[model samples]
Target: MLQYLTVPVTAFAQNCSIVWCDQTMDAAIIDPGGDLDRLLVEVKRLHLNLQAIWLTHAHIDHAGGTAELAERLQLPIIGPHPGDQFWIDGLAQQSQMFGFPHADPFTPTRWLQDGDSVQIGQSTLAVRHCPGHTPGHVVFHSAEAQRAFVGDVLFAGGIGRTDFPQGNHQQLLDSIKERLWPMGDATVFIPGHGPESTFGHERRFNPYVGTP
Candidate 1:
């Protein structure tokens, strides 16, 4: 069985998910935005052994606490795509620009790619490269679980902004229509923020998807 725990962190309130295989207790941290101590606490409480840290993008609100957490957990950070390398490298500057404490640039131990599988305990998460929110933004999907974690790409009622650095409005739209919309209406959508929704709900009501 697989277990999920959502911890909203940082000023942006990004949802940091801890997903693990129940039997092996092997875990992976998804977008440890901030509050490293709290995340560590949860890890201890769950008695989970940290295996890897995955990032959906390199935004400060999503990867801000990565360096600190990785250092403490003694685990390698894994990025599914390389397009976000600029953002990852400029983390400190981005933090400073936002008036937040600077976050050190974290080097990823491995890069995640489209159609790749990231193992978490017994199951694997399928990577879908959904850019526009960030050049390398990705959504992780588990077919067996029928759940997907979309990091700031699409939300319940809206979609991510394309005004940020390297954000391409057209590409983002294409990504949604081609990559996400085909996931089936029954897929569960676990966004980076706000409440969860189903693909069916978003397809029917989300303004970004038009009045389908």
Candidate 2:
């Protein structure tokens, strides 16, 4: 079975997920934005065989701790789309600007693209390049689990902000309605911040992108 736990990290309260394959006990930390101590505790408590670190995007709140964690564990880092390289390059600046702990910039072992797939032990996740919150944002979906980690793309009753340099309102909406909605109304998603929500609930109530 596949299971996951969401840990809210950083002052921004980003939801960092620790996903694992129950049968193999192999795990991957998704979006280790911060709170390294707490995250490590969970890993130890669960007796998970920590594998790689997966990212949704390079925003400081979602990726501030990637380099440090990956280096300390000698684990590889994967994801966010390659287009978000500029954000990765600005980690330090972003941290300082946001009053977060200093963040180091590092390259991902593999840059994800739409239609890409990643693994956590025996579990596989389908990756979709859903850029809008950032130019290279991506969503990870575990088909067997019917779950997705959507980094700042869609909130419970709202959508990603499009005021950033590379943001586009239309692109964000399109990604949700076209790419995400098709995932099925039963699909549950974990956002970078806020409470989790199913596609069906958001499709009906989200004013920004909901169907009338």
Identify the candidate with maximal TM-score. 2
Off by over 4 Å in 2: none
Query: Worst 10-residue stretch by lDDT in candidate 2?
Result: 203-212
What lDDT does candidate 1 reach at residue 24?
92
Predicted structure with the largest lDDT when compared to the true one: 2
The lDDT of each candidate is 0.87, 0.93
lDDT of 1 by residue, 1-212 (tens): 66789999887888999988888999999998788888889999999998989899999889998898889869889884899999988999989988666799978998888888788889788899999989999889887788888989888898889999899988998888888878878988788999888888888898887557
RMSD of each: 1.1, 0.7
Give per-residue CA lDDT, model 2, range 85-132, as digits (tens). 999999999999999999999989999999999998889999999988
TM-score of each: 0.96, 0.98
Compared with the true structure, model 1 gives a TM-score of 0.96
Model 2 clashing-pair count:
0
